[model samples]
Target: MKIGGLIKFTLIDFPGRPAAVIFTQGCNFRCRYCHNPELVYPHLFTEPVPQEEIFSFLQRRQGTLEGVVISGGEPTLQEGLIPFTADIKKMGYAVKLDTNGARPDVLAELLDKKLLDYIAMDLKAPLDKYSLITSVDTPPEILMKSMQLIRQSGVAYEFRTTYDKEVLTDADIQALEKLTDKEHYRVQECLPVAKEKAALKVLHKEI
Candidate 1:
């Protein structure tokens, strides 16, 4: 767990449950409208928060916080994710994972082991516009598989899009809907946020 930052308590991140959010330090996607550029760009990364300190806090918050949100810079990049999550589960908190669906293999393993209570995948764009939006070459199959896994895993989940007008057209949004289950999807307004304050603000509002 290369933790860049931690929100000790949050009401909106885990839907109905109050939870603490751990923002991991690396990302695979480079979305143009992403507010957390400090987490995405390696040169902007800060020293990671100590895992011992994080666990100790979680231990103290056991009864107060009902859930833990493993957010990113793509948490699937962390090799310690499984054991870290297992440790939190042992602490009696539900775990929700927020991801870009870049790692279906990791998602599959977590689902197979029943490790997640909820999963939220960011739908960056329509399949054809993915690379244009992310500024990286992405395999559409990867996202497609990840979506399928989340949909069928029996784990509660949602697919969310930032809905950047500069990047996505109405047709693109409609096309994105076809790529995911509409019942489990949402579109969030894209806001202009300062990079420094964005971390705290983005967590309060949807991306």
Candidate 2:
């Protein structure tokens, strides 16, 4: 599925499970602070890792890993996502999908197929400031739709916002919080690198 990067193993990515991470290429948003610029920016994309290669690795790690995280430059943006995820599921690994929640139809289809075990959706900003943060004219309705779908899907999930003090203020965060039911919402600080570490210092703290 046009995978741009792969982390063979991780202890924390999948939450309570040992897992492998597949980083797909190409994103719809252009958040300036995006850590993986190469994955998001077309001009910087590297040669895609062969799907077969990833399959072989997964095959070997079948028993060792408990889950597979299909992350991206926006995994739903990949054309082969459904089939690719099906293949992973067939191999007996639970799948955790990380997305920007822009594609509700795709998310719904995956849910209908019982493909995702966990989902982590990024809430970019308060509805009115979405375009300003993402650097694109994304329809707020689409994001809202996906959020609703995830909430109803009955799968374990979390809603998160990457807080960059310069881009999202305390008021913006409070407004963003009003949009979710607070079941599993999180406020993440933006990291400059690909591996994002959740800062417990900010967990559930009023912005």
Candidate 3:
């Protein structure tokens, strides 16, 4: 895993469980309101926290922490993700993945292996407006495929959107709502670009 950084612990990230967060390096989307630019931009990439260092910490926290959240710069982008997650699963820690749903193939593999206990996927915009919000030519069908996989995987999950009224309108949000079961949808307020990445993973609020 090309880890960008980690939060030693957090109460808000993994639903109902105390957990540590691993932020991976590199993202497919460049949302205008992104808070962790350092993780996204190649120019801002830092030396990865050694994989051994990360596992050592997890090994120590094994009994205390109930889960581990693999967040991003898009977690599915990592070539080492499956094994990395499998290693965590071996520690008897429940795993949660936060992703943009761009790689259904990878998500499918993880689900098939029962590597993830929870999933939080960001729904950037209604299918037609994804490019406007993510600043990339994201295929609507690609996003749809991921959503389908997440919903059918029988994994506990939520589809969330960052709420920045200026960037996403009420109409747009409603349109996005139409795309998912409201019981599993949420909205989070987007924060400004931060110099520090700690505690950025706030609990999601109902839409």
Candidate 4:
């Protein structure tokens, strides 16, 4: 995997555990309010984080850190993810994957192999507004399939949306309810990064 960034430790990223977060580069979705804009836009790809260095840090923190969170522009997009995560698993660390859920086959394989401990899939928008929110041409059909796969996968998972008012509205929420069973969804307040603070505050008020 081409690791774009590595957070040595995080308290909130992986539920209760202190974990390392590996941010992979490149994404299929170009969400306008994406805080990690560098990850999504390849033109700005940062130098890859040295894998050996990351592994060494993980090894040192083995007893202290309980888990590792593999997040990305889209972690599943990287073909090396399985083997890379497999290595982490061997180091006796629980693994959690944060994905866009576009690749069901990869998700299935990882779960089947018991390589992942938890999964977090993002709902970019209401079904119909996917392309609009992503700022890219997205196939609603494929996204629907991914949603179904996750629901039925029986893995510990959460379906979350970063509710941004500029891209999502009440009508979009209704459309989301129609597309997905609302019982499985979680809506979160969009946290403002330094660059996105003003816009996020205004949208927070609207929400």
Candidate 5:
């Protein structure tokens, strides 16, 4: 629970439920279009938010908030994540995890314990192009294992991709269809920022 940031409350994070957002610091990947760059790169990390403060706030909002969203720098990266999620479940709050699907083991453990109510796993690329999008050395097989676990878990989940010029294209979208079942897929328009935004605008104009 190395909490780097906290959104006291959020209405849109968890589907159909108001919840608090717990942002864990330090991501494994570094996407250039990433809006939350601070959370990804430790060089940009901010002061750590006390876990007690976060729990106290959740305690106060217990009745009002329906769930909690564990998002990151990769929530699964935190060693304290499982126990922390269990604590939230103890409070009778549903938990939703936003992840990159790198750690199927942790995800499976949480699912087995009923610690996660929902999951939204990001599909960085169409298997072959993951490294290009994530700016990391990711094995496509590792992510596929996670996807398989998610599909077999019988939990509510969606696989999503963020579209950006350097990553996806019309052809790539069609290519992605062959990578995974369409029933579990979603394509999100990339909302860029700073230099990335400028790059995307140029790409949009060209399109």
Candidate 6:
């Protein structure tokens, strides 16, 4: 739980609730259009905010904040994620997780424990173009398995893709239809020069 950044309040992040956003550090995927380069690129990362500091803030916001959003450089990558989220839930706040869907095992465990209230998984691209878009050698099956786990977990969830014309084509979006029906999917526009505020607006919206 290395917290790279913290947004004390957000109206749109958790859907129908006021919440705080904790941005974790380090990512497995290196998408070219990633807006949070500080979270993803090690060289760009700043000193991590202490865990106690985050907890203290959450404690103070107890009645004010309805939920907590655990977003990341891939939150599941952090080994302490489950415990961290459990603690948040214990604090009487609902929790939401944003991830790349590369680790189905971790996702399953959290769902099994009823630790997350909502889950948002990013679909980097169609199976054939995944590696090219993610800039990693991610197995398509792994991503597919994560999708299956989310759908079957019966937890509220959404599958989203950043629509970057250079990295993903119209056909790629069409292919994503095979993964989930329309109700559970969203396509966000990712402009090359968009700032964090713009990106956050796109990422936090419900379809």
- Model 1 over residues 1-207: C-alpha lDDT tens digits? 888888888999998999999899889888887778767889988778889988999999989999999998999989999889988898899999999999999999888888899999999988888887799998989999999999999999999999999879998888888877689889998877575465655543431
Query: Which digits, one per residue and each the tens of the lDDT, describe model 3 over residues 88-141?
Result: 999999999999999999999999999999999999988877887789998877
Q: Tell me the spans in candidate 4 whose CA falls farther than 4 Å from its real position.
A: 174-184, 193-207
Which residue segments of model 3 deviate by more than 4 Å?
A: 195-207
Ranking by TM-score: 1, 3, 6, 2, 5, 4
Candidate 4 lDDT trough over 10 residues, lowest sum:
198-207
* TM-score for all models, in order of appearance: 0.93, 0.91, 0.93, 0.87, 0.90, 0.92
Model 3, residue 35: C-alpha shift (Å): 0.7
* Residue range with the least summed lDDT across 10 consecutive positions in model 5: 198-207
lDDT head-to-head 1 vs 2, winner: 1
TM-score of 5: 0.90
For candidate 2, report its TM-score.
Answer: 0.91
Q: Ten consecutive residues with minimal summed lDDT in candidate 3?
A: 198-207
The lDDT, on a scale of 0 to 1, for candidate 6 is 0.87
Q: Which residue pairs clash within candidate 3?
A: none
Model 4 lDDT tens row, 1-207 = 787777777898887788988889899887777877667778877677778977998999999999999998899999888899999999999999999888887887888788988788898887667877687876777777777777777777777888888778977766766666677677887767666545323422331
Clashes of 4: 0
Candidate 2 lDDT, 126-206, residue by residue in tens: 988888778998888899999999999999999999998887899988887888856688898888653541221121121
On residues 7-123, what C-alpha lDDT tens digit does candidate 5 reach at each position? 666788788899988878888898767867767777877677788988888899989999999997799999989899999999999999999998888998998898888899998
Write one digit per residue (lDDT tens) for candidate 6, span 103-154: 9999989998999889999988888888887889988889989999889887
RMSD from true fold, candidate 6: 4.1
Minimal lDDT window, size 10, model 1:
198-207
